[model samples]
Target: MKSIIFIETTKSGSSREAIKTADRLGFYTVLFTERPNFMAKREEFPDVHFMKLCDLSDMNVLQKEVKALILKGIEVSAIVSYVDPHSYTACTLADHFNLNHFSTEGMKNIQNKIQSRELLKNSSVTPEYWTVVTKAECKELEPKIKNKFPLVMKSPKSTGSKDVYKVGNLIEYRKRYNTLSTLYENQPILIEEYLPEPQYLVEVVVHKGKVHIMAIIKQDIQYNRRFIVMGYKLLLNPGVRFSNGLMKAIKEIVAKHGLETGPCHLELRRKGNQWKLIEINARISGAGMNNMIKAAYGINLVEEMLKMALGNDPDLTPKFQKNVYMQYVTVEKKGTLEKVTGKRKALASQGVVEVYVKPRKGSVITPPLSMGHRYAYVTAVGNTAIEAEANAKKAAAEIQFWIKESPKEKITTVIQ
Candidate 1:
């Protein structure tokens, strides 16, 4: 039997869901991760093969390790990944095996914001961007920085808006730059034109060079010091005028990037008539959003990813069973996660499928600098966008992140 290789699963029980899908489709799972301590006993992972690597980030070493296994006559069917760190590995290994996959180099262009902007320099979608690697570079770029006042600063390679900030002037710029410099210690910092919000997340699945619009997610974003993605409401009928135009632009953009197969999650914003590009990730959205997509559209993006991985066709044809669905969640200020309130109330609400508050009592909480820090998640569905959003909102409002204060000195996070 052929084996499906996962560089690392994003979450437990096979991160990609591709693993389970592939397993059900008659394929074995080969997991390569740095966590040798995890499931130390072979019996703990039934029908799953595990391999240890000194460093999953060392591409050469990981490739060599896998090549050694291949040399031993192990038959593998496909390569798939869910997280960012291992995405390149999946692309590289798939390319090595001559499997249908996107370009690894193409992924690099977008992963590095500086390179991504360079690629789009001549395109209409390009934004004015510069890299500040040194303090001296910061001083030198002040003129252009001031010209494009209210600039957005971010790490060249980052997600969940970790160090992303908006600065109106030089002082604010210096403060953000210094904070980031202190955090990253000389890593490349990106400064781009601050695009207006009312942001949209487009989930696109590409197979055999064909692009499919799976779902256009609407996000309620809060950018007060921290870029917070509060929740999302799936727009079932984005309308022909919107869909046709957006799809055309996306198809052109994907073709421009030379993205081949698999899932690509795009962050978009429309300023007036123009659909501005925020960032494009060559993987599925993080934080179980795939489940939300399935709940709304009756399409499993992960399953599509699996099909594409195994050289099979995906059913992109829409089976739009329902109009709206949502996944609502929240993060908390610095404190210990005490008790959760209104969970039962939320669960009992109509159209609310489930409620989950991740942190247990005494679990410390911090500013949501990344997706993992999110406190809870609620999945809801309804016939209309308003109803779905209301259900999600009510459920979210019902649950509270009751936190007890921790010593301010104990918090070493910069977000504070």
Candidate 2:
């Protein structure tokens, strides 16, 4: 029998769900996670294996040890990484093993924000205005860019909404830029015209150059400094034309950019009757959004991505059971955890599937308004979209979080 090696850094939903998929795929799953305390849910399963990976970025060392493992009777057929940064190493390792995989060179186009914008703009999938910021360069290009109120400034290589900020005028822009420069130490930033409207998330799965629209997810986002997605629901019934002129445009762009395999998650917004592409991700969306799609639609995209990596034909079915929502219980603000109630009651409610809590009593939690700070998430599924939304909202409201005067930082992670 073959084996699957999952490459992950942190123990987020992606890490846990990767293990679950490995079990479903009937392969001996080996989890390579970052150093000490890589929460191995091995106790929940008898077949899966977990290994602490010290440094996955060191490709030369990793390749040598991986080759040795294969020689020592470990049948690792595919390497998988859902996280974007680790994707580079995953693709390189797969290439070294002569395994089917996405190109590391192509990953270069996705990891760097500037490159991705250029690619999208060239294909006409991007908005009209975009600028790159450096401590030495932003001032020179300021005059060229239209100083529209509520402009967005963000790190070129960031996920979630950690360093994303919206500024109204020059004073606010300079202040925010100074703060970020002090904190991030001169990382290149992206400045763009903000599109104020409802955002739609499109997840597409590809196998052997065939693209399948996996799900149309409606995002519920919170505006702190920038847009941070709190939760989402799979909109089975879309009023908007999903497969019209817009889809054809995106398909051509993806093909032109040579993103022929794997799963692609993109964010778009409808502004005054026109759809605009925001950004595209070469990997799975963070926060187990793909798993929610799997629960609603019978398409196991994680499994499909794995199958594609193994050079096997994937089952891309259009079968979908409507009315399901995936919600992540998020931290609202920085505070000391004093109370958490009604969890038991909410779990007992209909359509409430799972609850995963990271912070306990006395654990200081940061509100998820920013990508840098999110406590935990709650996921629920229902019979209809209304039922699903209602159930999730009920659960969210029922659970109360009491804060203390002074809170400490306990959980540290990116919003994604």
Model 1 accuracy (lDDT, Cα): 0.73
> Could you give candidate 2's per-residue lDDT for residues 220-262 as a string of tens digits?
8878666767678788867556556446656765675577677
For 1-416, candidate 1 gives per-residue lDDT tens digits of 57778777644322646666666777767878776655465465554655454577777876776676678787777777877767767887778778645667766555666766677778766566888889999999998778788889988767777778989899999999998898889798988888775889899887767888888988777666767777777887788888887887788778777777667888888766667788898788876577777777678777777877777788876666564555545554678776667789988988887666666788888777666667677778887877877777777677766666733322221211
Worst 10 contiguous positions by lDDT, candidate 1 = 407-416
Write down the worst ten-residue block by lDDT for model 2. 406-415
Global lDDT for candidate 2? 0.69
Supply the TM-score for candidate 1. Answer: 0.88
